[model samples]
Target: MFPPTPPIPEELTLVVDGLTYAGLAFGPVDAPPVLALHGWQDNANSFLQLARALPDVRLVALDLSGHGQSSHRSADATYQIWDDLPQLVGVLDALGWAQCAVLGHSRGAIIATLLAATQPERVHTLITLDSMLPRPAKDEDFAKTLRAFLKDRTALLNRSPRQFASEQAFVERRARMGEPPLVSTVLADRALKPCDDGFAHRNDPRHNGASAVRMNEGQCISVLQALAMPVLNIWATPRQGLEDDIARQRALIAENVPNVTSVDIPGHHHWHMEPEPAEQIAAAIRHFLV
Candidate 1:
């Protein structure tokens, strides 16, 4: 059994294309809306502390499809990063919002960039944490990657979701799977759910598959070049060889995007989950959004 979650104020639900997307909301409802999005496998809870740190604005952090409590896409649908943009736009439109600021982390940030660049009027400001793009297409062997994607997708469909002895163990299991934080609380916050037999993760396993196709560097550069919004990129220090790549991405954005402000914050990929780093993120957001 899992321990009870401490009370989170303002539970939210967004129904899009007949699917339910669950989230947590904070601050005043009438304030300029800011939609917060979590990364790959991360849920809406990723923004819990960050929302608490920024009470001056309305923040609604949603569990992107197949993560957290959000409904999974149909079996035929792929979980490509670009597929999230229309659903995201639909959510804001359903909320009667013509335009709203977007705050996304890692994979979610890629979606934000896509939205801001392609549909410029729909996004007010763009803020990303830790990553720019997932695997760039330029560096990929598409034939090999597509084959792996098919294999993994088919495998997941036939396999049952993994179960755990207890929710705490499930959280501990997840902590070891990623870039791993020294503390488990952040991942633990949205990592598990009760299942028929035992506790299991909330994310869909199909997400483990390789991308069927990816945005090549040129495509990514074109989008970054078109962005006219005030963009804030709060990046974390990547591990060794990864640092140079992120620096290159940052330089690309700075060169192309008209109004871009970037700052390096401490901690690993999911730094926004911790209080200290969340505060740093909030400060940058406050400065940029203003």
Candidate 2:
């Protein structure tokens, strides 16, 4: 049928701001470089399927801070979206890449959007899977949002990691959380760490905390308008269709960005992590890059 699946990628580690970032690097060293950013709660392995689909492009997928084998941030450091910029810059510096394409999924996609808008010169091409930007905040709800965030921050500070009795238990739990078994198994391989009692997730508890703030509508529009490089916005068309707000925002982004190509493929939110959809997405990315 298709080309044989690619082998597991080589592990890579980069130190930035005293934090160790873990990732997987694949494809030829001389091919066009593309940074891959996975969604929230997902590790570098999220791109495994997509990597298997596209053997021509060089891809480096990171676990980002607080996720997978990456070192967690200091106790005082927050997990805000913008807080990742410095680490990203460091990763780029380590790779000696002055400019390259970026591929992001869900939460990672939003971060990529922000990066493309704020540091347009460093990102030559942007490809976002199933997201454009974070949910916009309303002025009227600012106070309430701040209070909730503070409460969440305090509540999760002392929370303990959840453990699973066995490997199957962990995979089943992850499956119940929405991912298919195939996808869950791939993710569980990296997300689960052996403990005294059982295996527990390695992600930082603070990663589950609420964000302190989100950009407002006008601010998001400004970001959309700031994208000067070619952008491929690929979103899944769920059976229920896109949510009104998300659809509206996606439309707004496409309208504001000068060189954006929008493609809606049939699948769910984590479609890029699935076998069939990953093929379709990889094809779209390959064509877009060309």
Candidate 3:
């Protein structure tokens, strides 16, 4: 059986610019906070295992816009990798945190990197799990990317939320969508909601559409180079098709970022969610934060 989940996290709501964000807070309220962000299709509970491992460090894990209990962006907006930036800043200001450590997994890791790069003064320590930069696209693919994004967007807009027979079935279906092949029930609970019969997803459908735009390698490099804050990049063994991107970004970070500590650990991309890997990751983070 999996390690027991920590106590039910305290519920929290942060509002900024008329938008409200829902999140879970763990550990002592007085401890210096580490704003935690989850990956694509994941939510605040993504950090549960890690939070349990690091009981002394306060973790405020937010369900980003379009995901979990958070509000979706206005109809005019799109889920670009950078779209969450201003909202995150607003969340920090609302929390009265001028500067604090930040932790992100997958898509969240990309956002944390963007935050550290654009608002260097507000992040003291950066810890990225299994990812650091956005997937880069080539300049020649811009038109194709835009067209494909539009098509996907239109298609998804006309679709209705799909309900599953049971939460377990939904979790199994989700696990089949990617590598590691494991799903946490805690995460499933946060990502799902009861509907007419079984359960419907809580995530915004737009999240499944292709991004209208993406930063190219050169752009990603500039962002990586701009990271002046101390960073702890904890990456798992890359999945089959990710080897190239992983190698490429590691090279870029090794060459450009001066104060980064890169560590390779075992497990798949969501390693931080499992007990043993979470403990290992906690040790690295604890050492880095100290």
* Prediction RMSDs, each to the true structure: 3.8, 1.4, 1.9
Clashes of each: 0, 0, 0
Q: Would you estimate the TM-scores of all the predictions?
A: 0.92, 0.96, 0.96
- Tens digits of per-residue lDDT for model 1 on 198-278? 777777888878888877778888888878888888888755668677777777887778888888887788888777777
Q: Which window of ten consecutive residues has the lowest lDDT sum in model 1?
A: 1-10
User: Which ranges of candidate 2 are over 4 A from the true structure?
Assistant: 239-242
- Residue 45 of model 1 has an lDDT of 79
Put down candidate 2 lDDT per residue, 37-58, tens digits, no spaces.
Answer: 9889889999998999888878
Model 1: colliding residue pairs: none
Model 3, 1-290: lDDT tens per residue?
23476656899999877777999998888898999999998999888888888888779999999889998878778898899899999999988899989999999999999999999999988999999988789999999999999999888875777778788887778677763444446677878889888898888899999999989999988998899899999999856788998998888888988799999889888888888988899989888888
How far residue 89's Cα lies from its native spot in candidate 2, in Å, is: 0.8
Candidate 1 runs further than 4 Å off: 1-7, 178-184
Q: Best candidate per TM-score, number?
A: 2
Q: Model 3: runs farther than 4 Å from truth? A: 1-4, 179-184
Model 1 has an lDDT value of 0.79
